[model samples]
Target chain A: MLTQRQVRLAWLLVLPTLLVVVLVAGYPLAQVFYWSLFRADIAFVEPPEFLGFKNYLYLLQDPDFRQALWNTVKFTVFSVSLETLLGLAIALVIHSNFKGRGLVRTAILIPWAIPTVVSAKMWQWMLHDVYGVINILGVKLGILSQKVAFLARPELVLPAIIAVDVWKTTPFMALLLLAGLQLIPEELYEAASIDGATRWQQFWTITLPLLTPALVVALIFRTLDALRVFDVIFVMSGVNPATRTLAVYNRQTLIDFQDLGYGSAISVAILVLIFLFVVAYMRTLGREALR
Target chain B: MRTWLRLGNRLLFYLLVVFVVVYSVFPFYWAVISSFKPSDALFASDPNFLPLPFTLDHYKNVFLQANFGRNLLNSVVVAGGATLLSLVLGVLAAYALGRLPFPPRNAVLYLVLAMTMFPQISVLGGLFMLLRQAGLFNTHMGLILSYLLFTLPFTVWVLVGYFKGLPRELEEAAYVDGATPLQTLVRIMLPLTGPGLVTTGLLAFIAAWNEYLFALTFTVGDKVKTVPPAIASFGGATPFEIPWGSIMAASVVVTVPLVVLVLIFQQRIVAGLTAGAVKG
Candidate 1:
């Protein structure tokens, strides 16, 4: 399994990728870690002062960071769960006999393919209070007595954002699950039906078990993406703590507020949280995803 | 009773299908129609659902008036450059990892995948500092370099599976012809990677094009700005005005080509996506 020539060849091939990754990923990661120790406020006319553990200590008590953490968890949990359920339903439906199946699949990719910024902006226009179509449609359809501002209110912001996310990403989840659905043999379903196993029973005992790997992988990907949510929320509500995510709050601190060290600390906190999620998933889910 | 049940099931299935299509396509349709409408019509209490009496003023504003075309060009350059570089590096790494018995091979693969999971925020400050120090703060090259974080890992992860999927007999024949591993890869396996290249390259281009935060953070001037940030920053002449028409037009302009590409390559894209996830 171990050959010197093979190892040399592989390194020769992989050298450039390794080099770029170290520069773009590894070095920046190290720099963030290093800066987490200092108080690097760019707004002041002073050099960064080393203040080990202080930024992190303050971060532990930071109200904004806490709110962001809560918001991220809420967005991640709600959006991922909804996307999974809807994605699963769509996959199952389209997996079986359906007219225009290819057309339906292609139709769904439109939402997923539209740029996130465009999605946010388009929805922003639609969710406008006075002249927006969503409000207009809601009133006309008797879903609402009057127009409602979807993005401005604290109560509705996360839900509005989740709806937008689900719209954009459910197709993606459906595609992944559909791929998993295709992997299971038709014979299994045929034999089960012959054995008098109802479709529901077949789904529970066979489909669900076989789909767990794809489902788990999809969850991990979406969770990581949701955990780092930005553009959509940022575009809809600019730095509003009502919907500020981990990345948003970090951007506010680091870029907007110019608290580089404190921002780096926030960045490290986010890094660790995601790191923990990956590690935990690898531990419990048994790394079927890696295969 | 059985006939009634079958009829109801068909009706429900068709109903679900309609809902899915409308839900997915309606907003995009709305965006297109809105882009064509005049400002006065847009502000009316009851909106026109159709693009009647359409005006091209918004498109005029986006092209003739603003620097959107330049921004689009910047996006094309950056996305194109990053995709080309990523495909080259990814192909190299994938071939080596898929074929060779290398030490730390598995570790490298894990590392490549791990980069995607890294909190991009963790690297933002450092990347900013590095770019500024290198005098590449607002350059397309810098944007392309920084985009390795997103594009490279994806290409490598997807292409690894593509490389692995190739039959071993080809490689053995190349070896029997006294070809070195590199020659076998360059001459034989490389030629067969046409489809894999197209899929990964298109996906990478799309990823680079859609990126916002990094572009927003890195570039400060209009010359190097891309569509997402450029569109985000579009506004009316006054603080009270939002220029909804212009924003919608810009959105439509940048979105149509991508939507077409995705529709055309939907099958390959699905293959690429599942390979990234399920095949590792």
Candidate 2:
């Protein structure tokens, strides 16, 4: 049933995209795998020496690598979970019929729209231990006896970074959930109310089950973004290892230390980790979400 | 009892609305106000939340002292160039994938999705080498070329949804008229998908404008560096001395234009964003 001309036209149009993708992504990714096997440093004069899986072997034993991995997972899990709960609350509230609803919806986009670096910089100033408004307000309200160095403290830095990520991303999650909320028919709610169901019962019985598809998609999307978080933490955390996620750590290895082979190995590890995440997500959520 | 319960629910609803608005809007508000505060007032003991004793020195300093004008120009060129390139390539690809009933359509789409999710850090070494070899390292075009990795996926995916939503009759009519595929796309479909193009273009521009990782790695000199890196590199006279007010001014200046544009095209942008995930 297919015409040869149509197929040819399709390939012609799609070929450019494939070419660009392969040049920028696919081939570079292959190059990364190749580079991962050699001990190459940008600073060195000699050609790279092949080490096979030695870089990966050292990576397994490297505590810094493990810490960065832990930091990435912690940030992703905590931030995404917080964003989900807060995003759900926001979606429910914004979905309600109210005056100024449109303004509230647009206002929430401010955080999401601003560049990540700008948001991080804004918080960097606000989290200042001495002159910060957060501490000023806290001291005024008697919540703290003195100012706490938010970014400098090892224990608090990751949480502080997570707070920034949550602040920036919750709006995005809310919008997706809001779209899902709109898809639920009003007649179902009306019928439930007419059947003597309480508000809580209606929500538990009607809203959540219907919203699962949207929720799953939103979770996966946010998880994918969070797993590669860089800008907010990089701009805010200064030189703290406590806040160094996988992307930030990888940048350090590739650009700062100039250890090309080790850095490429880390890159390979990250891809494998992300690939596993996508596979697990598919297995659990089923392919219906993709469609 | 029922009246009290109803009153409680009403109060809770209003409270939640207030919390949401305040939580989301307060940071930008703080940034705007802080940008105008004098250095003395910025670090005052009882800091003035209002823009009292306002000063334009921060804005003046951001441009005069920081060489930020050059960075702004660089951002405009890079983001603008990337947006235009992505739109061109994206429209062609979107036309094929969305309408043409091509073999391997599903595979190509998934390939695009995977690329969209491809970690930039993974490709940092490879891209660095490629850019250097092309003699484009530390140049605007390099950033634009690398940006294709993110912007292309977004424009194609969103425009695919837009193209698919169009009626098949239009294309068929063009075919009946003996129009070439390019002619039909240019003469018939392009006019109809104007809003899609604008929405996708604006989103891509904002993305490239805001990108930090590629921009940071690809460019070094202020002659080539974009706003994000320029702003990140800001420091005071001494290591301990931080220019909080100047950084805020840069943030507000960079953000206000985007916020205004987003406000104007909110609906289209929202539709474009959800069209991908919901349809997928």
Candidate 3:
């Protein structure tokens, strides 16, 4: 339906964006791939050496990489699951036609608007070992006798980070689900009620099916973000190997250890893993164009 | 039986709303209060909800001693620059995809989304090297470019949806009246999609302002360091203990603008942002 002139103008319009992407994203990505084949220096002054697949081989054997990969998986599963559940609950509450629902909706988004660093910092204070509100309440309530280092211990670090993720992002999930909830006609529920449907029955037959699409979209977005979890853990636990995810590990490899080739391989690996997940997710939801 | 059940459901709904409201708002309220509390009150054996011996010392220190004002100005400039850059680029790209019969439109969008999922760490290695070679390593321009990795993709995706949803007849009418393509786009399309642009622009601004990874990785000295990194530095555990009051004060400085903005545009922001995913 478009004329040749319109088409030309369209291409002209997109040129600047395409150029920026090529220069910034495209160039760097190509450079990383190129660097992956070279002997990237750990020390600044070493001359570059050709190392084909050697860097990737070394990375595959690295214990830290394996551990970080595991931690990322664990964090994604726990954080996304909790966020979806809590988000659905919160959304249902806000979606209902109740007094002050608007106020509640506004209130929930405050946490989401606050930067990740600020949220993590606040929680760090709350989770501090000695005088934190969490420990204080814990001891008073007989949850723990003595102070416990939440981020200091490796096993506890992932859970703590996941908890923050859940708290911060559940509101986002709620917002998305609430929007979806608005789309479902009230007449369907009214008809169900007229049919003498029980609350559980209405939920199972009406709400669940109608809400599935929103849930899937929320899941994909959350999973994608969780897989790239960095800022929260990074700000809370700086350079702590025990708590580092793949992102933190990749950062350490490049910035801390100055190993460009190994870091790029890790980055590429994470990209492939996330892309696979996204493809599967989109196909399952029948929304592949969402890519 | 139905009446009893209706009554019970009503009670449960109210209960849930109350609980959610309290849970959501309490931490923010506590943060504001804690910011005002005296340093002694933070450590007192008995803590109250209110800052009894109130003081402005923490705020004063945040402004004067911590150089929070400088960081705030830097955040504004960086966030403003990123917003403007992404808006201009995003609007153009979105217009192309929405109106023009471009081959591989869907593929390009998918690629953009995939790029968004590209983790910040992956690009840091090569980007650091590239920036160093180009002599932009510690510059604001370097930080801004890194943030575009996030802001640009989102702007294009969101704005494309917004532009597509708008009626094309408006632009067509303008063209018929002798407005050129650029003029029609500016005079006709831009004004119509004002809300969409602002909504997406605000989201981009917040992301840039809040960015932590590149800001920390690229810039070291306070000359270009941002609020997030500044906040982190205040709490670094040295031989001396972390300063909780100062940290809280700094958080207040960082979060206050975001809080005010959200409060003002709560409706448009919530609706505009969620519209992209849900409506799409």
Candidate 4:
């Protein structure tokens, strides 16, 4: 029920944002699609020659691209699952009546507030083979026979990166889940307790089901972020190949190797994968909500 | 038996709380302590939890030798400029979406959200080219423009939510008083959404400040580098040396302000984040 004048004013108001978005995001996105179809190398003294689908064809055979895709999937699955489980536990604990609850919440947010690169740098020093406190801690706790090169070892590097991601992002997940936990009416829990439900039963039947919406939202956000993770891997293990996610690999290809066409192909592939994930996730969540 | 079970549960809860606190706070604590330790003490055989005989050498090195001061200034300008630009554009768009019954409102909202989720790397190649063409590459303006890709969408989404929640009666009354939509927005709505503006603005500032990939890609020289890249590329006298103490000092310098702001606005930040995320 709006007048034409109001509608025109609305369009006028939204014009600036729309223009900025188009200039900054929309135009570049179209450019990415255009660039992906060529053989362009900025470092090479030659112009871009269109090679429709050739760049993507090469990507199909690129072992590094495959490995990066695998690494990204592995990182996303492991980190998001671990973060969710740990976040749930922490959220449940903090949701309860406790002394210093507010203080604990603020403390946990410190890690999230710290820039990712700084956290990665801090962990790099803490994981140093010789001078690291983690090694010293391991030895004292009887967990290790000697200092282990956590970031250098191929088997341990990805896990080490995952551990750092878990530490930095678990609090964010907990915060989101805690918000969801608060929305569950207290009377529901009270009624369950009055009906002779055990604590564990109440949790399984009440908390898990009621927290699904937040859980789904948090999972999607974390998964999307984890898929394109760059800062942690870049700062911690640059071009290591062992822990290179798609975003890091894409940067290496574009900036380091100057392979513009190939890099754009990778970027487009990532966008496609993420879009599909989001669509499928929203669809399933929509169905669940309907049920 | 019931009393015993209750006691055990209480003990476990306390232990879990302690673990959460220690895990979250200890890294920053250790970083601060390490920043104050002398080079020799840092590599000592025994790791000290506390900085015994604290030294300011690392801080001095960071400021005097490492060129971190310039980098900090760059981060402030880029992040601050981006925040201001996005807030202005976002408020107008959000006001439109929230107040006016515009056609395609949902489509516009979804478009903005989709832009936020798009992988930043996807745009790096194109954005780099665009910036170069516009003669903005390696400039603060380039980074600011690139950052709008994230900040604008986020600001619009959060502020839209805020504006929707504001009382409609105020705008109607203003309308009856012969106030235009723009006038109502500026004269009436802006005053009411003060807290929302602060929350959204702070979150946008934080995002731009912490941004890494674009800053790393867009800027090259020490003149234009931000804290993340500067800290990442920090080195010692030798190629093999890492200069951990100085790096920790720079980290402390870059992080302490953000931690203080986050602590002060913890409640509002949480509100804005959840409003943008969970509600959507």
Candidate 5:
């Protein structure tokens, strides 16, 4: 614990990795922060002017940015809640002793394994106005009077993107919860059973309490990821700045519009939000997951 | 009365299982079957569940003309290179953190794990500026380095668990036998954590292989493009006329490797997926 030589050796070993991380991650992070305060043009920059807080102030007044904030929050809350419930239900069902449980567990992972772009495209085709299977089934089953343009209608677009997200991510949630479920000692359940406890009572007393850590971890991960949603919305709704979340909008500002200062400010805001989530997660995870 | 209740429970469980499977697997099956049918038949009023008059024209076009193969190759090179590099670097970092007692060791670990949660959006602006300046923009090298943002953290986290699970005495014994630290690591510790190595490597590969956002933003030319963006907007060239058959064929081709891996190592896949959640 106290040898200088040992410490030196350890540092030497870690030096290369640290260098790579700094070069790859640290440098870019610093550059972005630097760029966010200047009038950096993509095409022509004779001498970039320093414009501190101007970009952020402009963004605050921007209607599109405000709408994006609201959309991100709405998407995260709805998607995370639904994914958790569905994940828990699926986990519980599979946790019980059943035939072909192995097969079922593997089947569940198919959605999570498929690349997000493929799944988003699949749903896009299914939600197409005229010939989508979803509309076909909806009309046949009398769910809708006529074909609905799921991606076209502004009202339905967000929900449609959320649906694709939920479809793709619920399996991931269920897999994590299933691992948590598997950890609870069978002895505790058996002991409760011998005490004449009903299944519902046993689950309340034993299962849910022990599952809190995993549930919180899953929720935090999913919610944080969802809040920065981009691909599904970008692919399905065509990144019109109306359906943009923080991520999609940030892309528009930097790449499409080349507003580096404004984009960096948005990025800074997102970084702060993520930092808050990590701290909250660390508190709930109680130092174990950190290990 | 107890037997009757048990019977009902069994029936309900089976029904639920059936429902989950159908809900999960139907779309994949739909994509596969639809890839074979012609476009006119796809929009038919009374649709047949199976592909009637099956054809290989879709696969033919996807391979012959769509340049999907080039995209697939680029993804393989980028994903494969990133995974390999991260595995080597991450393993070293993980080993040092796990074995060596250094100042701020715990702090470093926490920082790396926390970085895993940093949404890509937050860093995109900064990363773009830096990369463009460094001449890394619109290059495969840039994509690989950017992917390390997720892969390195993920690899280190998974390997921490693996390194912890390994017995210290084995490596201690090797060191006592006069082997150098590097020798002990390469010859002794690594071989023992074979399964962990495979699982971590596989997860890293999959994440990089499927990544869409960075690849989409960074790589403009087909020479450096990856599969996700290519497949995502396959119809953009001719917006009105979707090459549905070719798109489905490409999806199938891209998906087959992952599907096969799942079938072969289903248990390991499940274990790997939830590596962070459950532990002994």
Candidate 6:
């Protein structure tokens, strides 16, 4: 179907993107993998010595790394599940006819648009032990007996972080699901109604099955992001061992401690975990799509 | 009885809408009002939701004392430069992938998507060494190049979808007139995909502006630092005091422009974000 000139032209056009990707993404990934096999601490005068598998072995025994791995899993599971449910509800509500639908849609996007660091800082203020509006309101409304330090308490920090993640990203999930919701033919719903299907029955039978693709995409994206979450956790908690995710721990190891080998090992671990998640996600979705 | 049930459902639906709007809007709204309060008023025992007798001192402190104005300029230059570069490269590649009958096109597209999934920290150590060797460390160029990691993938992915959606008949007509492929793209397709360009460009700019980890790791000097790091490193006049007011003010300054853009291009943004995901 194609001529020789078109193939040549296509290659010509795609060359630059390929080159940039190679220089930036490809080379660095290889370098990270290579670096992970050595003991490369920059603070010492010695050059990096090869210690194949030792760095990864050290990480398996490292308490901080294990804690970080656990924290990342907890964060991803809690935040993604909550966001999916809340986002589905929101998308359903916004899909219906309303007078100020445009305004509501635009308003909801503001949270998503704001930079994560800024939102974290804003929430930091609101979660302050003293003078925080959240504490003020909680006390007044009898939700708490007195002011509680939301981010400072070890028991509460992870939940607090999840709440913020849910707040910022539920809109994005909703937007994606809303697009899927809109794609369903109106006739299907009308047909269901004529068959005396209840509202909940129509939702279960027609809406959910059709929305599965979008749900998969949204879940994968959010889960991946949650796994590597750095900005909010770093800014809000600052290397607090309790709240550190894998990405933040990797940064601290590489940058602060100048432990290149250990950091790259952590990086590789994170990548492997994410890869497994993506593979599982694709397999399930592929099977479901065929069905 | 049926009417009552319908009325109850409507009330619950309206209540859910109200909750969504308020939950989304309140934090930013609170940040804006808090930015206007004086430091003393902000720290008052009873928090004032409204900024009574609002002051601009915090804004003044951000611009004058914290030297945030320079950081704001740095953000604009870096984010703007990255977006423009990615857009140029992305359009060319997207045109090929979307229009040309190239073998392995799906593979190439998926490869780009895979690049986006690589956690940034995994690349940081190698990139730091490479950039330093290239004499780009702590430079805007380094940050810009690194930004390609995210921006290029997103731009190409979105634009490919946009290009695919264009009518094939238009390109065929141009070819019949003896126009070259390049000529058709420039003279015809470019004008038609204006909205796509805006959507992709805005998203790229926002991503680059909001990037924190790379900017924090790569750049060290105050002169090169972007707004996120600048705000992160901001300190009170005294070491013992935290400048919440000035910090809030700077947060407002950095966020307002993005909020304005989102409001203006709400529909386009939603379309661009969902296009690739839903289609895939």
How many steric overlaps are in each model, in order? 0, 2, 0, 0, 1, 0
Tens-digit lDDT track for model 2 on A1-291?
336788899999999888989888887888889999999995556689999999999999999999999999999999999999999999999898989999999989899899999999988888888988888899899998989999888999899889988999999899999999999999999999999999899999999988988999899889989998899989988546888888899989998889899999999999999889988997878477555
lDDT of each residue in B1-280, candidate 3, tens digit only: 9999989988988888888887777666666777888877877655667877788888887887777887887788778888999999999998888766787788878877666666666677777877788888878787787788889888898888888988878887877798877787788888988999999999899889889888888887777788988888773347477777778888977888898889889888887668656643
TM-score of every candidate relative to the true structure: 0.97, 0.98, 0.95, 0.98, 0.95, 0.97
Query: Candidate 2: what is its chain A TM-score?
Result: 0.96
Model 1 lDDT tens row, B72-180: 9999999999999999999999999888887788899889888877777778888987788788899999999999898999899888888888999999998888888
**Total clashes in model 5, counting residue pairs 3 or more apart in sequence or in different chains:** 1
Q: Which residue pairs collide, candidate 5?
A: A32-B126
Clash tally for model 6: 0
Report every candidate's CA lDDT. 0.90, 0.90, 0.82, 0.92, 0.82, 0.89
- Badly placed stretches (over 4 Å) of model 6 are A42-44, B1-5
* Model 1 iRMSD vs. native: 1.2
Candidate 3, lDDT over the whole model: 0.82
Q: Could you give the interface RMSD of each candidate, to one decimal?
A: 1.2, 1.0, 1.6, 0.8, 2.1, 1.1
After TM-score superposition, the amount by which residue A80's alpha carbon in candidate 4 deviates from its true location, in angstroms, is 0.2
Candidate 4 docking category?
Answer: high
Best by lDDT: 4
**TM value for model 2:** 0.98
Share of true Cα-Cα contacts across chains kept by each model = 0.82, 0.76, 0.68, 0.79, 0.62, 0.79
Candidate 6 chain A worst ten-residue window by lDDT: A282-291
| iRMSD computed for candidate 4 | 0.8
Between 1 and 5, whose lDDT is larger?
1
Compared with the true structure, what per-residue lDDT tens digits does model 5 show for residues A1-291?
A: 235655776788677677777776787788777877878764445467799878778878999889889889999999999999989999998898878988888788888888888888888777878877889989999999999998888888888888889889999899888888888999999999999999999989999988887887788779878988888888877676557788898888888887777788888877887777767766877466445
What docking grade does candidate 5 earn?
A: medium
Better of 1 and 5 by DockQ: 1
